[model samples]
Target: MTVRKATDVFSEWALRDRDEGMEEGHAKSVNDMLKMVIPKFTSPFSVIDVGCGNGWVCRYLESIENCYKAVGVDGSKEMILKAKIKGDGEFHLAQLPFWKPSIKFDLIHSMEFLYYLHDPFEMLKIFYEEWLKPGGILIAGIDHYSENTISLGWPKALNVNMSTFSENEWRKAMLDAGFIDVKIQRVGIKEGFVGTLAMLGQKLN
Candidate 1:
């Protein structure tokens, strides 16, 4: 019997959540990253969102006054289809650790997507080396990190591979990935839930 991959299951789950929109309670954490990130753009910038489920964030980034282009790529074809219909970004269906963009981006963002990789730190290195231009910024928003007890069962429950790294471990990974000034900040705290953590990194020449 052939077994289905965990990513396939996650794709199906995300497709079901497509119509819910980013206004859902769980998405508010990434909204805080958006607040902090959008203002830092001094010039017209291009963005690529990795694992951009439903493309809501891509749509919002495109609406920004200084945004030149916003592109979203996800592994789920259904999610990309829904994003095309309900959101306003160049959405593409691509599997990661292999898909390479035609052009590098000034900003690369991923919300709650990195942990799904078996070795998220290696993916971070790949993103820094291939996806981001020099001086570009990459922010990974994570809710299922080691510190977030609320998400301890996510891997088992979803039957997916999740790398539960500590806050400092994530930082060290970013720094080791040739990113400078790596900083991990917690955002969007709500009662009874661990706040989202933003791993911010910059590629400086």
Candidate 2:
């Protein structure tokens, strides 16, 4: 059996129009993450959505009156192309844990993305130090984690590498990555589904 790269699989999803379905599937969890986050930005804010599959979140962020900038970055070429075609905000083609943005943002978001990396905390460190401004917030959501139980087979199913750490481990990893005041919240649970485990952290001022 051959293990496949997550981005390559997602690029195919982009070509097949599966990205829209992914947006729909993750919408509830995404909304829950935003509900807690949006209130923090009393003034104008800028955001970057890592692993932005098709820029849906980027467009939504741009629609908010207080959002000065909304940028979407993804490793998949097809996904970025599709995002650009959708036409709402700036979209960049870049791989995580390696590609750093030219500027930082007030808020950084990643959903169901970090686990794909060999060292997810390496990307978290970058998110804390390079991707976010001082006093910035980082929100990372992952569905595949230990204790979730249902998600344990995701790596094998998708043929992609995923770091299956427990919830506490994720929080500790965030703290280890230099994110202060780290917290985790579970949201959007339904029948037979364990809600998304959203890790919230703040870059120290």
Best by TM-score: 2
Per-residue lDDT of candidate 1, residues 1-205 (tens digit): 3434545875676666833554375467778887777787899999998888778888888888899999999887777887898865698898887688999999998987888777888899999999999999998898898889879997777667778999898988999999998879998788887798898888986
Clash totals for all models, in order? Answer: 0, 0
Backbone clash pairs for candidate 2 read: none
Q: Which candidate comes out best when scored by lDDT?
A: 2
Task: Give stretches of model 1 more than 4 Å off.
Answer: 1-6, 18-23
Candidate 2 differs from the real structure by a C-alpha RMSD in angstroms, to one decimal, of 0.9
Candidate 1 TM-score over all chains jointly = 0.92
Candidate 1: 10-residue stretch with minimal lDDT: 18-27
Give one digit per residue, the lDDT tens place, for model 2 in 1-205.
7888889999999999999999999999999999978999999999999999999999999999999999999999999999999985799998777788899999998888989899998888888888899999999899999989989988888888888999999989999999888889898887888899999989998
Q: Which ten residues in a row have the lowest lDDT in candidate 2?
A: 88-97
Candidate 2 residues lying further than 4 Å off, grouped into runs, are none
Q: In model 1, state the lDDT of residue 118.
A: 78
